[model samples]
Target: MSPERFARINQMLDNRQIDLTVCLDKVHKTNNIAAVIRSADCVGIHQIHAVWPDIDMRVSGNTASGSQQWVKTIKHYRFEEAEQAFNAQNMQILTTTFSDTAVDYRDIDYTKPTAIVMGNERDGTSPEAIAAASQHILIPMIGMVQSLNVSVAAALVMYEAQRQRQLANMYGTRKLDHAYCQTMLFEQGHPVYAKACRRKQIPYPSIDEQGQIVASTEWWQRMRAPDPQALTC
Candidate 1:
């Protein structure tokens, strides 16, 4: 709640890049969910729409860390709750499955508003959830195992989303649109950070209007005024 803490929250929000959301469809294992959260943050995603019928955190552990401080994780009591949330935002959902219509993960157009639904560790997304998905994606494998750990699969696909968004200059000219950036900035860190930045006279991280971190800030406004109350925590 202190300005210092608020500023740090803002910093995390500024750095988030992917607009991708990960849906842990009935993911019961805490470790898997936690690991996925860590992975989501690693790739700069700021929002995670998870279907946690029972929001258990012991398994996720530090994997979620202070991410919720920066990442605005939306919780859905039902799988459909998760679906409606994203669909309302016009974000297309991408599910990991081997349906006849499945596309290679690499082929998905990550630049668009996107969400990925990762089903249970034991059983993948339910047929109902998949039916609601905007599209289906699958990671090709040479081994007998059809998929990697949910966290690993997320990392692979998310990076590609980052890559495609980059190609589109999601940071340069196109930039993260204002809505996504601001929502991320607001969630990643504390809301008070914005006031802290103004008080500290610091150049808040290089954020697009939407609050997404600009990959390169050579052209951004450079300022680093210390928080007036930096001496106080």
Candidate 2:
């Protein structure tokens, strides 16, 4: 990796928000899925949760615009499973819905660990999601169209969180796990070698401050050796 590229990756990693995330509740549209991910990436979200009961539903690579490379998506087959995962992370789940108890999206304190749950394009949030949410949020719309697109609503909510976090000086610092940061640095800074290591079933090597690989001679020999399974390909 060049020094400039390494610096850029380090800067991005430093700004990553480990505690902020989004949850999709049965959002089946490919465009919407991709848009949400792209927006999440722009706002420094490291990961997002998605519930896909229908296995056929997936994000379109073309629509994702390479955002998937930076923003990881964790798939869940059930709503309850996603909820449990959020609870384990100690995130306050906020569902976007219109109810008597629902408050403005801007009212919540985004400085804390938060997970905003968005519903499907048509049916809106599921009953279980609404019931499980720690708080319900709504974006006030005075116009005739009382609703906005799912992705649009999510972007608004995410930006609100970002704005609050920025005011609190939450950016420009590394909050991700040390091991995870090292793995990302290696995979992103030296993608070619990372791919080779995976295909050859070799463990990743440590990267030095100068962005050079630091591995033993034995490891180098294994890396240069021909793949025993190459003939199968």
Candidate 3:
């Protein structure tokens, strides 16, 4: 990897918000999903959770654009599963829903560990999701339209979270694990060798501070070996 590229990736990794994320409840549209993920990457969100009951609704690579390389989309078959995972993380779940008690999205304290939940394009947030949320939030719209598009709503909420966190100086330090950072550096910086390791079922070698791969002679031999399964095919 070039020094410039390595430096850029390191800068991004340094600002990642390990405590903040988004959860999609049956958001089936590929375009909307892509837009949300793109926005998430722009705001330094490392990953987003998605509840996809229908297998066909998965995001396509074309729709995801280049942001897919940086942001991870974690899939879940059920809302309950996503909810349990979020709860275990101790993140305050904020659902985008309109209710008597629902507050303006800007009013919430986003500096805390937060997971903003956006629902499907058609039905909006599921009742179970709303019930599980620590608070219901909505973007105030004065026009005839009662709600914004799912992706638009998600971007709005995520930016608010980013704004609050930024003001509190949350973006200054590195929050991700050291091992995770090294893995990302290798995969993104030296993508060819990273793919080679996967193809040959060889474990990844450690990366040094100068963006160089550090591997033993045995590991190198394994990486250079042809894949038996690929040869047969």
Q: List lDDT for all candidates, in order.
A: 0.70, 0.92, 0.90
Instruction: Name the best candidate (by lDDT).
Output: 2
Error of 3 at 11 (Å): 1.0
Between candidates 2 and 3, the one scoring higher on TM-score is 2
Give candidate 2 misplaced runs (Cα > 4 Å). Answer: none
Model 2 per-residue lDDT tens digits across residues 1-233 = 99999998889899999999999999988899999999999999999999888666678888789899889999988989989988998999999999999999999999989999999989999998999999999999999997899999999999999999999999999998878877888999989889989999999998887877899999999999998679577
The estimated TM-scores of all candidates read: 0.68, 0.96, 0.95
Candidate 1 C-alpha lDDT tens digits along 138-217: 99999987779887887788788878876786643323556655544543443465555557554445445443445434
Residue-level lDDT tens digits of model 3 in 8-54? 99999999998899999898888899999989999999999998886
Worst 10 residues of 3 by lDDT: 55-64
**Candidate closest to the true structure, highest TM-score:** 2
Q: Give the distance in Å from residue 180's predicted Cα in candidate 1 to where it truly belongs.
A: 11
TM-score of 2: 0.96
Stretches > 4 Å off in candidate 3: none
In candidate 3, position 195 carries an lDDT of 89
lDDT (0-100) at residue 207 of candidate 3? Answer: 91
Candidate 2 lDDT score relative to the true structure: 0.92
Q: Which ten residues in a row have the lowest lDDT in candidate 1?
A: 215-224
